[model samples]
Target: MATHPTFITCSSVSFSWPDGTEVLDDFRLAVGPGRTGLIGLNGSGKSTLLKLFAGELTPAEGTIRTVGEVGYLPQNLVLDTALRVDEVLGIAATRAALHAIEAGDVAEEHFAAVGDDWDVEERARATLDQLGLGHIGLDRTIGEVSGGESVLLRLAALLLARPDILLLDEPTNNLDLHARARLYDAVDAWSGVLVVVSHDRQLLERVDQIADLREGEVTWYGGTYSAYEEALAAEQEAAERMVRVAEADVQRQKRELSDAQMKLARRKRYGQKSFENKVVPKIVANNRRAAAQVSAGKHRALHTERLAEARERLDLAEEAVRDDDEIRIELPRTLVHPGREVLRLSGLELQYGARVAGEFELRGPERVALVGRNGAGKSTLLRTIAGELEPVAGTVETHVPLRFLPQRLDVLDDELSVVENVARFAPEATANTVRARLARFLFKGARADRPTGTLSGGERFRATLAALLLAEPAPQLLMLDEPTNNLDMASVRKLTAALEAYEGALIVASHDVPFLESLGITRWLLLDGELRATSPEEVGSAVR
Candidate 1:
């Protein structure tokens, strides 16, 4: 494979949180001018590394160097809602100056501001149009657009700046299918040094290479995410084989050491017996015993050293194997009998002028995927069903105990421990019971005791999921809005596994088609202005 010239370098970089949690220590990475997908498990410092590259964060030690201008889009994009689209796009000043000049003001200052870029507004509009934001006028406020549009708007601003190095962190989090397609198109169009930290499988497939960040080190893999997976699978297979060989070597070394010790013991006994029986002269017997003792010592030392080396080799071999744990828990209480009435929506009129076309009913343990374009009221419908929001002019009737996990995951109390949070949802359950259940969610011992605010993205999701599934009365109706957003691929898979054990009526609002397909969704509903029946095959076109 051809290699691009290196444009960014981090030499012996070290960083830690205020809580003394070491994220990266003496980490070195060199990225060239190509699309590199930075991927890792949650809390592996993918975002932190991107921040360092964008100069949003300074390393505690070592140095970072970049060859050209850098632009960054953070995982959590916070922008002032009052700012105008042009201002957010960073062309407000130029547009203002151009307008002034066009009005015959002829001010030198206006001309200087314009600075040969007289078509700033045209360029801004072009960028927005490219990102599928043409309908969003440049004069509109950021608050007027959908959350997904705001993300694209930020990306548009970065593109307008024309930076040499572009660093994006989880850029497709809240995007719908159409918006995500636009973002993917933008990614495909990028030619400069592009390093994106994302869990979006489709987005990662477009990258030129994959940079797997694990244990404070970056391991580069040629080709896209699928190719990276293939390479990693092969690598792990070899590592496991080495581990088996090393295990055998360790066992053989232990057996040899034991055998040598037994032989030495027998030799000592024989020497003592011969000395006592006067088989040889006393002086000669004593000398022979000493010599035997020395020989036994040498043999014991040699065997012990070999065993130690073998154990060390085994440890190293074992370290090469990945330990990606899956969530495994059964929820018998959440199971609903066949033909059970789970949910009903009568003349459902949701907020923001969205409504269901007619009466809708869900029965038994139906798994439904609610998909739509941005600003299509999918979340509003889920919120209404979950009883967090009041319907404008209709009714949402859930027949069984229900729980909703929103996109923000605000169900958790940031100040409380995971155990406490779960207890909050299931107040009648004892601390021991809650902890035991939390352990099944991969929060064992001290992990269950850590505050929810201190957890990584994946850990927080698990903690929240544990609380919801273990809630009092058990939720037979579960609604999740964009549950897979901002989640790592592993977390997504773990979530799929966890949900597989759930025998409840599931309604997940997501743009992640692959994840939805994995859930055994029996029904697909597209929420545009009204809820309509869809299919896994029609989902791609229906949302667009």
Candidate 2:
């Protein structure tokens, strides 16, 4: 780990949405010059905090200050397709001014616009080249480039700004493998106060430190994301051990309290019996009973206080335990036989004419990874197979029921609740049954009733998955296009757990190598212009 001067600070910062949901309150953070990966569970306000740092969102209370200029790249970057590449790189004015000067029309405004960046054009071209966008000329419109290239173009713009602080929110969301590598190189090369909000483990590995935002507070970890995970695991293990000890102590205190009560009751009974038997003088007996009662009362109070203290300790110990919920659900009905033919693509050609070179067959409960560059038509292929889009040529035949979980997760109705959405898919299921299944997707109790429109990125993804899984007749083939996009690590884990139980054939189009590997993918296909069987190493090499 390294240390640098604090360049960004937030003091007593508080922010809440219009719905009165507080994201950050009395928050305090100071970031120094270095790459710091910002991570948190979904809805924990990672994006909101980045927005606050970028001054895109004003805090409800307190103040934020920065040492110098800031540049921010949002998660959902929407550049006007008609805009030229130079404009996106923010060098249009400079290029124009330089051109005018070269044309011998040296106006004062043109010189001012050019400033000291006389080499701006060269710098811009170099930046674009660094991000693998050199082929995309400055004059080309954004619509002419791929989605991943567009993202890099945005980053190139930020680099051109040369801001003291750079903030990126899920910069690799829609990027392909090669694009991710390009972005990773950019992050590794960054020397400013860089704070990136991302769940990409590979990207997080490039950071000098990790800022774990949890429960509205930032906890600094001394190293990368893996280091943070190791520290967190050790902490949780110790906490669990403490909880066990506390539980034992609480039980001991309870037993002691019960024994004290029993002893006091026996003494009271014996005293009454002695008094009735006339074993002593009435006055003596009265004194003995009074003394005994007072002693008993004190003993009872002491035991009660001890018990309460023990319970409090137990509660505190329990609070230290992490709440890492897993998605647990049975998917027996979704299972497919090993001999069953689940998918067959015969000379399939997508709308954009990225064709499968020959016949393809996916049998049994095979897990397949579809790897390709961003405009390589992975989504188009998946949609065409799902019957959402008609293919340009060839035929796609499915022997079993299938479901496609698109990148947008638009299958869910925004107006409906999570349970309601599931019910739509499972029309035969009762309300209670729908809720019971929804709980396995991590939507339980009142949360299951939350409108789909209000759910966070991860929650919405889970709800969409639940709908697809719980649909009637059970889909034996599930297709997911970049399912891990925008999901936090926790959500990714939950999804992995859910998919673990799925015995259906799965064709997932994703660039997340770790996630794809975790799925135990039986086959890997690279769809550049034609689909071909490939290995992970080949895929990595191709992208690199």
Compared with the true structure, all predictions reach lDDT values of 0.87, 0.86
Q: Candidate 2's error at 526, in angstroms?
A: 1.0
Query: Model 2 TM-score?
Result: 0.89
* Model 1: per-residue Cα lDDT over 143-205, one tens digit each: 777677889999999999988899998899889888888999989998889999888889999
Best by TM-score: 1
Clashing pairs in 2: none
lDDT for residue 73 in candidate 1, whole number 0-100: 92
**Model 2, CA-based lDDT:** 0.86
Candidate 1 collision pairs? none
Residue 337 Cα positional deviation in candidate 1, in Å, after optimal superposition:
3.2
> Candidate 2 regions off by >4 Å?
1-6, 329-332, 337-346, 351-353, 387-400, 410-434, 449-454, 471-473
